[model samples]
Target chain A: MNKPLAAIAAFAGLVFLGSGAWMLAGHFRAQDAVLVEIVQDGKVLYTVDLASEEDRSIRIEGADSWNLVTVRGGEIFMEEAGCPDQTCVKMGVLRAENLPIVCLPNKLVIRFADSQEVS
Target chain B: MKLTTRRLTELALLTAAALIIFVIELRIPDLVPIPGVKLGLANIITVYAVFRYKPEETALIVLCRILLGSMFAGRPSAILYSAAGAALCLIGMLAVRRFIPPKWIWLCSVLGAIFHNTGQILAAMVLMKTAVIVSYIPVLLFTGCIAGAFTGLCAQMLVARIDRKPPA
Candidate 1:
């Protein structure tokens, strides 16, 4: 009811609504995009066409950690990680455009490329 | 700032308590796959200390906790991200403290969480050197708000209870 409380509430509301909308848009827009990139330490290690790539696994080694990136049946997922948290492995699959599969400890990122970037 | 023996002891105790909470929270399975998302239960102490102690004192406790916590977790690599998030969160909460009375400490906590998320994302971008990392901003912000509110509300209840008790 107080002014500051009201302001805080309004600010949180805006963030919640805006983020929710952005995430939704990102998810919907992610469909039909097949190009996925595997990046580590800011460098692109591999850029594969998921829709056309063969079912194979790529082992990416970082400075102190490693990740097993697998593409199966046209879907990409982190099969394993040397890091303890295993967050990237649990990310299941690279689904949303805005949500990349990340392993902070290993400094690895697996994300879908922008559709425009597709050749 | 003159830190009397009693003040020093109090800060040390708060830091230890926060470190314990941080370690315990690590045991909890990741609620989501995102790198920066968590309950951040240790921040409850930070929120309580922000309102109860001087800004410099609160900063000391947080810094100590982050250093010790990284060692305990055996994830030295994560120290950078944790430090970035904690520093931004502390500064933001300290500045916002003036507007929020004890009753609304949760609001300050929420704002602090936002700052913490921003710091983590920025650190990730710089360290990863990838513009694609920007895509994570929305999800991290969304989760940060929830985690921040939870920790803030816990700290608010803690403050209420501690204030009700007469100083011994």
Candidate 2:
């Protein structure tokens, strides 16, 4: 009912709306994300050009854990993991530029790492 | 802060209710694979307690729920993230309570949620020592607002309908 509080609420609401929209738009427009990187413990263990690299599975070992990352047909995803919560496996695939398939327990991540970003 | 029998009972009830919602939520299956994303339906109790009870009482209830929830769920690692989020959420709501009246409870809830997610992001950043995780904040912010609004309304309704001190 108060003006300042209402203004604060309106400002916050707009900020979230704008950020959500921008993130989503970027996600969709990132179809050119061809370079995929498999990062573990903040380190890139492998970088693959989905277009040129042959289909393969990379087994990432993490402090007494395992995550099987798969790359095929210009896409990468967590095929499976030894972690109790199969959150990464359920992520399906690494499609968006910002969104990444992550297995926290295993400390693994599969994300779109644009060619230049790949290390 | 005297621990009256009634206050003790209320705190216990609130903690139990939150834990139940948390456990049941675990069974609902992850709506998304992204870490730190959840409906957090249990937050309704925290939001309600923050408004209805003393600040310390609200903190106790939230602490008990976080500790016991993780213990029962057998995920000690989760305790870290949950604690961080709940602590920030509690602090944010309590501080903002002075400015926002009961009628604008939803705004307070949204603010609390934003703080909660920010806390989680900070925890993840510290633990992993990576900035890549920051990208998840926007998504969390978006979902946090919607979920916060729903739980906030639920709390507001309960507060309006139930008297803190029932006729003895």
Candidate 3:
């Protein structure tokens, strides 16, 4: 194999290994309270404690679209969206710290809040 | 960039082909729920163009594809993410092409994918004004590598088959 090709292969291998480990760490990380924040256009619209919050839905209106965030059974997921691609809705639930349910068109993000951010 | 008529026509044709691919791929169901995870099949044309044309010419094709693609998809907000990703991907591929032979085009494509994901994360960070999105980088990179290899292999095969000269 050529040197450049070998180098590229090595780089990709390292990236895969590193990223795989990172994601696994996120997955296996311990949890305290399941606090999630609903943010639109960088503003915190709502923060709900899934552990105690009742089953309810929040509607977020963006500049050009909308999203329905729902919490049920102590899980937060996108229930509906006005955007063409329902990627956020399909994400199912917010689990990993690294992976946030995102709706780009609506500029909405549903993610677990860092414990420090809680007050 | 001095564009001969033939070069201009080829660029236009490639742009159209990329737009069509972009629109068609939109019909495919989400392979994963993540926002940035995609096959990015339109990038096959991009990879082919990066190897076949000058950097500026390749850039033009990519720009045209993104602009027209978002319009057709009716998702104007997506244009920002796509444009940033394409720009970084193009620059990375173009720079790395010198080190990579045509036979190993997939390597360049993988690098491009990494750059593309980085650009997406950067755009998301700026737009969302939160570094929390940085956490998605690992997942995006993992997926980008796989998708990039597939599209790269497709481009490599096209490079092998197509003659550089236009048929008159």
Candidate 4:
């Protein structure tokens, strides 16, 4: 193999392995008793505990469309949306610390809130 | 560009193969809720095109593939994001092609990934009209590295195989 090719291959290998390890660590980490809030336009729209809430559904409407949000046993997700790309809905649920349940068209954010830790 | 029968056939075959891979990849269940994240198996064909074809020709192939692939997968709305990402990726890889030799194909792939993510974020920013979505940039960047490397390796193996064959 050519020297530059070999070097790139080595670098790729390192990146793949490193990311795999990072994901594994993230997957195994303990789940915290978190509070998730969906906010829009400076208003708190919906709030739920990620640990104790049962499976339920809610709908939020935008200027042009609406989104069906689901809350199952505390975890929140977008079940369906009327937006052009149902990307937020395709994203099943909010699980990771940094990953928020986001609806771009609606400007709605369902993420783990720091304020919930005390309550 | 003049389209010879032989080149046309080659393009069709490559398109068919890419579609097959795209369909097969769709069967794999998603592990995360993020809409953009995937193994990006179709990129294998893209990586090959970047090295083997002219920049314009490679772009045509990608555009056709992504358009048809999204239709086949029944995700019409996804075409925008895919188009944006593909456009950026194609530009970046084509530029890198000048500096990086075939040996460093993986570097080109990685750069393509970075550009792809940049394009997607740009779209998101425009559609959502806020910078808050920028938070996803780091995670996408991190994943881009891994996905780019895998696709690059696949392309490398493919180039080696093709090089071994005598030109017809």
lDDT of 2 by residue, A1-119 (tens): 77768875986698589769977876677377677777777788887888788889988787857988888887788898886667788889787777877676766777777464433
Tell the DockQ for candidate 4: 0.24
Between prediction 1 and prediction 2, which has the larger DockQ? 1
Cα lDDT tens digits, model 2, B22-76, are 9998889987667888888899999888778889999999999999998887667
RMSD values for the candidates in order, in angstroms, are: 2.2, 2.5, 2.2, 4.7
Clashing pairs in 4: A5-B103, A55-A73, A91-B33
TM-score pick, better of 2 and 4? 2
- How well does each candidate superpose onto the true structure, as a TM-score? 0.93, 0.91, 0.94, 0.74
Q: Give lDDT: candidate 4, residue B157.
A: 84
Q: What is the lDDT of residue B65 in candidate 1?
A: 90
Expressed as tens digits, the lDDT of each residue in A25-53 for candidate 1 is 87777377789988888888899898789
Off by over 4 Å in 1: A1-5, A116-119, B164-168
User: Over 4 Å off in model 3, which ranges?
Assistant: A116-119, B165-168
**Candidate 2, chain A: TM-score against the reference:** 0.83
| Error in Å for residue B145 of model 1 | 0.6
lDDT pick, better of 1 and 2: 1
Question: How accurate locally is residue A72 in candidate 3, as Cα lDDT from 0 to 100?
Answer: 93
**Fnat, one value per model:** 0.68, 0.45, 0.70, 0.20
